[model samples]
Target: MNEISSILAICGACISFYIGAGFATMQEVVQYEASYGSRFLIVILVAAAIYLYTNISFATNGNRLKLNRGGDIYGVYCGVFGEKIGKCAAMFFDYFSAFFCFMSFVVMCGGANSTLTQQWGAPFGVGAVTLTVLVVVTVVFGLQGIVNALSKIGPIIIAMILLVSVVTSVTGWGNFTGNLTKIDQGTYADVMQQVGGGNPLASGASYGGFVILWFAAFLSELGAKNKLKDVNIGMLLSAIFIFFAAGVCCVALIGHIDATAAADIPALVLAEQISPVVAVAFAIIICAGIYTSATPLLWTAVRKLADEGTVKYKAITVLAGAVGCGIACFVPYKELINVLYGLNGYLGFVLVFAMVAYDLRTKMSLKHGVENETAGIDR
Candidate 1:
């Protein structure tokens, strides 16, 4: 791909990957950041700063390393802490990718089933099966197919979200003010305590950490295929886009805090107020976002286990999808998400710490070399 197309593809992939079932449905925002009231603003700004720096680092460092397997970079940095432990952790995280993707797939399936049943009286089983089949077919084609699917779906979802956010903000300005008033009445301490584990800073930091883990391997592959400058620019643009889109969405959701607070699909509730047709349209967009997100995740997990373009790889993909569907059907989707993702977020923090240490050491070494070279020239 040319630089422009590569950049766009990277941008699309980043957005689509991050805006999974919870994000598109606004459940992530509502739970992670929004429910905290005024504290969410702190979360947004802090998380954005961390996201911007981390994503740029992921691209640049990943391009420099040119990793063959995603876990290889961990081996490079984790040498100080017993290579065996590091490699084991890396492998563990790789396997965890499947678990994460599986949960997301289930969440999306459940979301689709609920939306369809509520809107059109469609059977939940039918919706779940249909979404699972489509996702499986998309994953069977491998990385290129996943990227193509996401590149198409990502922009449409972003546009629809931006439109909904803007319109809702304008029409619900009064409610927005009312919500803000409600938030202002509560102390920040009380707000954070009520939200996630009584610590707003921890919640915000975990959000950044969890997101970095999500993109670590996937972005490494993406960055390897493109020029460093292009990847850097793409990441910068993607960060800005997310910041704007997220801000608007959060504002929209807060506008009708009471209704959305209890909603399974908060965005759907907001959309329905505008029109039933718009709500249905938003549900489709949610499914597309889910597909885009799940495709890469499934590919990432499968690639770890089997070589691409092989019969074994194809077989694994189908089997994995089938297992995932069965799990989705049996598990209570929301409860699984709460437990799995919450635990993953903490684990992700450890990886973030390692990354920061490695980066700082590398920078200091480069600076030391530069100073020595200058002294030699002076001599």
Candidate 2:
């Protein structure tokens, strides 16, 4: 086994895994892609670009700024907003991230369950329990374990997805040719064909363009220290892979069969056409992807609580997971996906705030330095 840095692995994992769960799922294929506001595959690719930027920046800031958690990261904002506003906003983003974290875990568990049972022979609940244990175990090791997975399994999974899809497409060249053409004519109704039926992603709200840009910045920040610089390049590469692999695969399955964009596991929908067995394997991989996606958010949220100096991590993790499981029991799994995604998107307002804070910090540092220089000259 070749040795690799854990941070790079995690960064690669999230880059490939974050938007990936939705990539082949009904919501991703039809809702986010064909049916949503922009209703374009281009939008997803662009979103991937935004994701790459923001996450990488955040991580870089975390490292360069000694930002272990939200406190260090938010210090820039505090310098700008005069503490009060900055603190409130920081608290909001952190808590909101945590809430979303809980929501993500639920969605992952549900998706994993549905995939295992529907695509594989395993019972749905079995998948849920298994994932629950996995999240707890992985996160207990904290960021290191997460980073290890990101660096190691992340690239392999990315390769697997591409390799499988490419093989499938080339082998079935006849289907690929026609399906590729059909995708050019995308629509809202086309997305409605999936499992979690929703009217596509739409919002009447606006936060100027900052929401979009801030998200872009945050995404770029997500890359771990080692692979941080590769974010933008990685996203562009990943986006092309995502669009062609996911979109084309969906079309192949429909093949003039008329399928909904809403199928929860659209990849599996496509995978089945190749082989029922392969489809099951695809579902397992997806389930693992969900686990990969959900755990980070969950760990971060609990870690935030610990960083506040308010709680024990073990206790906090248990409490947080318990709350998530409770909600999972009641909230319909499909709806949870929409709610969590929209909620995260709502953070656009604060993106500008985070940026301004950063700018102010730098300016103040420069100004203070120049004043000291002037004092020396006068003396």
Candidate 3:
């Protein structure tokens, strides 16, 4: 891949992976960050740092190792353990990606279904099936097609979200100030407790882990194909994009907590409160976010099983879509967000630990090598 093209593609893919329906609609942010009230900014900053560190590490290692699949990453890091344990970890990593992708696709379906039901008075199943069909068709064209589509659509989605968040914050200035006053009065702990359901630190850590795991495998291949500097640059730029988009959404949601507390999609709630036109525009953006994320995830899952461009790949894609659509019917949108995503966030921490350990070990070995070489030369 051309360096510039690869970098752009990687950036696009990263954004697309990170910004799903819940994220675009501000549900994830509210649950993970904004709900922390006065402490949310600290959590957000920490989350950003974690994201930056893990993504940069993944890109650098991926470039150094040139891995083809997610499983390869585990093997590379886990090899310090026994071979049998390393093999087991590698298998778990590969298969887990498929599971994660399927569940994410389900989330996309459920989120779109919720949107359709709320806005158009349509049946939830209609939205679910429609999203699944679109995602499967996109995946059939293979990874390149998914990457190209996300590269084009991801920025537009982010821009629309940022625009809506800014508008909400501006128009709902009273809500923001009122909440800020409450926080300033030292009711921060109470506000945070009521807004977010759990511990802010754990929530932030999980968010960081989830984002890194989402892109780790795909980025490894992406990093391998591009120059290291390009990969680093691409991830750095994308990290900034995610940070801004997420931060804006969190602020908007926190600003309007009273109005948004009961709403399924808080961003949409605030947008509709602003105007019907903005609401409609944001609904489309939400779908786009869900689409961009779902398409690539489905491809990642299926490609783990079948080679791209093969008949088997296409067939499995269809099978996977159908299964995902069927499963999407069983889970409520909220439960999927809290339960499924929460589970993934914790599971992601395992990968984070492994990567950190690998980095430390490598640094120590490099230091030892230099020290030994210097001593031998002096002797």
The residue-by-residue lDDT of candidate 1 on 290-322, one tens digit each, is: 777777777776777787788998898888777
Q: Order the candidate numbers by TM-score, best to worst.
A: 3, 1, 2
Clashing pairs in 1: none
Predicted candidate 2 versus true structure: per-residue lDDT over 1-379, tens digit per residue: 1223433444465544553355434444444444432234344454544444444455555444433343234444434555566666655555555555556677777776667766766854776777777787777777656756644555555555665556555655565345434544443343453222332222211111212322232342343234444543444454455455545543333342234345656567656656877776777667667677666767766775674233488778777776665556556655766555555554643564566546556558677873221110101
Can you give the TM-score per candidate against the true fold?
0.89, 0.73, 0.89
Question: Candidate 1 lDDT (Cα, whole model)?
Answer: 0.70
For candidate 1, the TM-score is 0.89
RMSD of 2: 6.7
Name the runs in model 3 displaced over 4 angstroms. Answer: 1-5, 180-197, 366-379
Alpha-carbon shift of residue 182 in model 3 (angstroms): 5.9
Candidate topping lDDT = 3
The TM-score measured for candidate 2 stands at 0.73
Displacement of residue 108 (Cα, Å) in model 3 is: 1.0
Clashing pairs in 3: none
